[model samples]
Structures are given as C-alpha cells and as structure tokens.
Target chain A: AQSVTQLDSQVPVFEEAPVELRCNYSSSVSVYLFWYVQYPNQGLQLLLKYLSGSTLVKGINGFEAEFNKSQTSFHLRKPSVHISDTAEYFCAVSPRGSNYKLTFGKGTLLTVNP
Target chain B: NAGVTQTPKFRILKIGQSMTLQCAQDMNHNYMYWYRQDPGMGLKLIYYSVGAGITDKGEVPNGYNVSRSTTEDFPLRLELAAPSQTSVYFCASSYSLDPDREDTDTQYFGPGTRLTVL
Candidate 1:
C-alpha cells in the first residue's frame, strides 16, 4: 500500500512572494507522483505529475515540483504567487506497476494574501 | 468534448434516505471512478469501474454501491445515508491503465456534487 503525507496543513503567503508545499510518500515499490489543485467548491484539477524522466517538472499557472527520490518527496514550488493561486493542494501517489488507483495526502490550503 | 459530467450540483438527504449520483463521460474513457472529498481531507475513492459491467470497491466503499451498465455511464448509489457520507463527490475518467501511458492516466474530473445528510 502507498500513502502520502503533506507536511503543512495550511500555508499563507503574500502576493508576489515565493512559496513551497512539502509532500512525502511511503511505498514499497516505485510510484508515480501527482499534484492536484482544488478551487473553492470545485473538483480537483491536475497541476502536475512526475512519472519518470526529469526530476524537475513544470505545471500550469507557473507551478513546478521537484521529485526527490532519495528523500521520497515531491514538493511544489512557485517563485511568485498570486491571489488567484489560493486553493487547496493535494499530493497523490500510485503504485508503479498497477492501475492508477491514487492514495492522496490530506491536503494543504494555500492562502495567497495581499 | 464535454469530458466527465456529474448531475445534481447539490443535494440534501435525511437519515436512511437513498440516492444515486449520476456520472457520464463523452471522452470514451474505459476507466471511471467515484471519489468523495471531506473537509481538510483529500479525495478518497469510493468505487471504480474498468469498463462496462465491471465494478470494484475502492479504499472507502462502505455504504456505497455502483453500477457500470454502459461505457459512458457510471452511477454511484448511496443506501441509508448517514451524516458521515455528507461530502463533495467527484466523478473522474481516464483513458487507459498502462503505467507508461501517464498522459492517458491524467484523469478529467467533473464539476462535483455536494451532498449534505442531516
């Protein structure tokens, strides 16, 4: 079984400030990592994913994540956040050699304050 | 394409009531899923179907039932609704199961239906 842990329950940042949301995972085998963003009262939208290849992956709305294999982490980063970036972010992991059944972290609410 | 679509944007149910959450996809996706999101918690899979006539329980499937009568439709049924079942439900679909097909596994989600049981 796989599980995800988001280090922070909430992150408040000022507009134009850089931000990072930490995520860690535990799994017996290799896994695929994903970041999803959910706006208020809406379903989740895929922000980015790390299946293979480069450790640094860029996503929509100027969001990016670095997959650290040694640390078992996939932390999301944005150089400059905006008010529109306020949302809940979730990290998910799926088994390496199976159907895509995701195990998600609790989530971290990103509040971009002016 | 309309992608994945779920009906009933919001609903309220009394204890012991029953209801079905309808889901349909126009993307010809073979894999459909039902997930519920609670406050502060991420989505938990309730049920899933790999194709028509094939349904399976997910991580949190208790008090829930599902049917995949057609490739385009997958409905989730709630029997004897409880307050614990009140949450936002989302329907998602993916094209295939191949791990190498990561692009295809990127699920498309619906608008979601918020249910409150009192």
Candidate 2:
C-alpha cells in the first residue's frame, strides 16, 4: 500500500518570490511520484512526475521538484512565483507495475499575493 | 483530442434520488477511473476500470457503481444519493502500464462534475 502527505495545507507567498511545496510518501515498495495543479473550477493538470532516472525533475510554469529517496520527499519549487501560479497543488503516488491505485495528498492551496 | 470528458457539469440531487454521471475519453486509454473531491479533502477514488469489461472498487466505492462496456466510456451510477455524497466528481484516464512497454502512469482529468445533494 502507498500514501501521500503534503506538508502544508496553505502557503502564501508574494509574486516574484521563491516558493516550495513539500510532499512525502510512505510505501513498502517502489512507487512513482507526481505533482498536479488545479486552477479554480478546473481539472487537475499534470505539473510533473518522477518515474525514474533523474532526482531533479522540471515541469511547466517554471516549476521543479526533487526526489529525495532518503527523506522520502518530492518537494516542488519555483524560482520566481507569478500571480497566475496561485492554485491548489496535489502530490500523488502509485505503486510500480500494473497497480492503478494512485493515492493523493490533501493538497496545498498556494496563494500568491502582489 | 478530448482527453477526458464528463457530462452534466453541475447537478443537484435530493435524498433517495438516483443519477448517472457520464464520462468519455478519446485517448483510447485502457484505464479509466472515477474520483470525488470534497472541500479540503483532496480526492477519493471511487472506481477504476483496467480495460473494457473489467472494473474494480477503489478507496471509497460505497453508494456508487460503474461499468466499462467500451474502451471510450465509463459511467458512474449513484443508486441512492445522500448529503454525504455531495462533492465534485472527476473522471480520469491513463494508458496501460506494461512491464515491457514504456511507463505511462500519468492520469488526464476531466473538467469535473459539481454535484450537490440536498
């Protein structure tokens, strides 16, 4: 079994400042990690995913996340925040192979202020 | 392509009512899933279909049913709606993850159905 935990429920940051969204997971086996963003009244969009290989992965909207196996964390970071970047971010995990169970965290509401 | 589409963008059902939320995808994916999102509750998996004619329960499958007759459609049925069931529902689809084939576990979501049960 696998589960996800997003550290923050809400994070407020100013535009042009850096921001980070922390996520951690618990599983007895290897799993895939993903970050999704949802705008107001919209569907969740894939921000990025960590299948394998690189520990540091980059996604759209100038977002990046690093997979730290030791800490069991996949934290999302943006170099410079934008007002448009304000949205709900979700961290998810699913076991390897054909297992289709994708567990998601409670989500973090990132509010970017001007 | 219309990755995933869910009909009846918004709906309100009374207690003991029944309804069906339609979901369709054009990606020809072998996997389809239903999820419900509540305020500050993230998302709870309702049901999932591995392929046509194969369906299974997820974390929260109570009060709901699903069938996958075709590769493009997977509709969710609410037998007896309750106020506890009021939430936004989202349908997602993804390609099959084969051991030999490339890994594609990314799930594409629909616009979601805002369900309100009184």
Candidate 3:
C-alpha cells in the first residue's frame, strides 16, 4: 500500500518569485512519483514524474521536482512564477510493476499573485 | 485524436437518482480508470479496467460500477446517487507500464464531469 502527503494546502506567491510544493509518500515497496497540475474547471495534467535515476526531473510549464529517497519526498519547484502558473497541484504515487492504482495527496492551491 | 472525452460536462441529480458518466479515449491505450475529486481533496480511484472485458475496483469503489466492452470506451455508473457522490469526476487512460523502461507511466485525463446530487 502507498499514500501521498502534500505539505501545504495553499501556497501564495508573487509573480517572478520562486515557489516550492512539498510532497511525501510512504510505501513498503519502491514507488513511482508524479506531479500533476489542474487549472480551473479542467482535468489534471501531468507536470512531471520520477520513476528511477535522476533524482531531479523536469516537467512542462517550466517546472521541476527533485526526488529524495532518504527523505521520502518529491518536492516540486519553479524558478520563477507567472500569473498563469496559478493552479491546483497534486502529487501522486503508485507501486512498481504493473500496479496502476495511484494514491494522491489532498492537493495544494498555488496562487500566483501579480 | 480526441485524446479523452467525457459527456455531460455538468449535471444535477436528485438523491437516489441514477446516471452514467461516459468516457472515451482515442489513444488506443490498454488501461482506463475512473477517479473522483472532492473539493480541495485529491482524486480517489473508483474503478479501472486493464482491457476490454476486465474490470476491477479501486480505493473507493463503493456506490460505483464500471464496464469495458471496447478499448475506446469506459463508462462509470452511479447507483442511488447521494450527496456524498457530488464531485468532479474524471476519466483517464494510460499506456501500460513497461518493466524494462525506467520512464514514468503517465495518465492522460479528460476535461471532467461535474455532478451535484441535491
């Protein structure tokens, strides 16, 4: 079994400022991590994912995340934020192999204020 | 390709009513899933299908049913709808994971269906 925990429920940041969304997971076996973004009134979109190798992974919309096994965290970061970057972000995890059940965190609303 | 499509973008059903949420994908993916997202909460899987003629339950399968008769369509049925079922429903599809490849398995989603049970 696996579960995801997103540290923040809401994150407010000014335009052009850096931002980070923290996510952690717990599982007995190796797991795959993913970050998804949801715009208003839309479905979730894949921003990035970490399967193996390269603890640091980059994703669409100029976003990136680092996977820290020891800390059991996959934190998403953006160097600079744009007003368009404001959206709900979700962190999800699924077990290795053919398992397709993804456990997701509650979510974090990233409000980029201009 | 249409990617993923869900009908009835919005709906309002009275308690104990029944309805079906339609989801279709043109990507020819082998895996399809149903998930519901409550306000401020993450999405929870309701049901999933590995392929045509095979279905399975997920984290939150109660009060929901699904069927996969074709590769392109997987519909979710809500029996005796309740207020608790009022949420945004999303249908997603993804290619099966490959053990040999380290690339992360990604799921593509539909626009979503917003349901309100009054």
Per-candidate total of colliding backbone pairs: 0, 0, 0
Model 2 chain B: weakest 10-residue lDDT segment is B96-105
Residue pairs of candidate 1 with colliding backbone atoms: none
Model 2: per-residue Cα lDDT at residue A67: 96
Candidate 3 residues B6-87, lDDT tens each?
9989999999999999999998788999999998778989999999999999989999999999999999999999999999
lDDT of 2 by residue, A29-67 (tens): 998899999999999999998888899999999999999
Q: Which ten residues in a row have the lowest lDDT in candidate 1 chain A?
A: A94-103
Regions of model 1 farther than 4 Å from truth: A97-99, B97-102
Off by over 4 Å in 3: B97-104
Docking class of 3: medium
Q: Residues A1-114, candidate 3, lDDT per residue (tens digit)?
A: 888999999999999999999999999989888999999999998899887789999999999999998999999999999999999999999886544678899999999998
Error of 3 at B59 (Å): 1.5
- List RMSD in Å for every model shown: 1.4, 1.4, 1.6
Cα lDDT of candidate 1 equals 0.91
- Residue B5 CA error for candidate 2 (Å)? 0.4
What is the Å distance of residue A19 in model 1 from its true position?
Answer: 0.5
Give one digit per residue, the lDDT tens place, for model 1 in A1-114.
989999999999999999999999999998889999999888889999887789999999999999998999999999999999999999999876454487889999999999
Residues B3-115, model 2: lDDT tens digits: 79999999999999999999999987899999999989899999999999999999999999999999999999999899999999999998865544443777889999999
Native interface contact recovery, all models: 0.56, 0.63, 0.66
**Model no. 3, DockQ:** 0.71
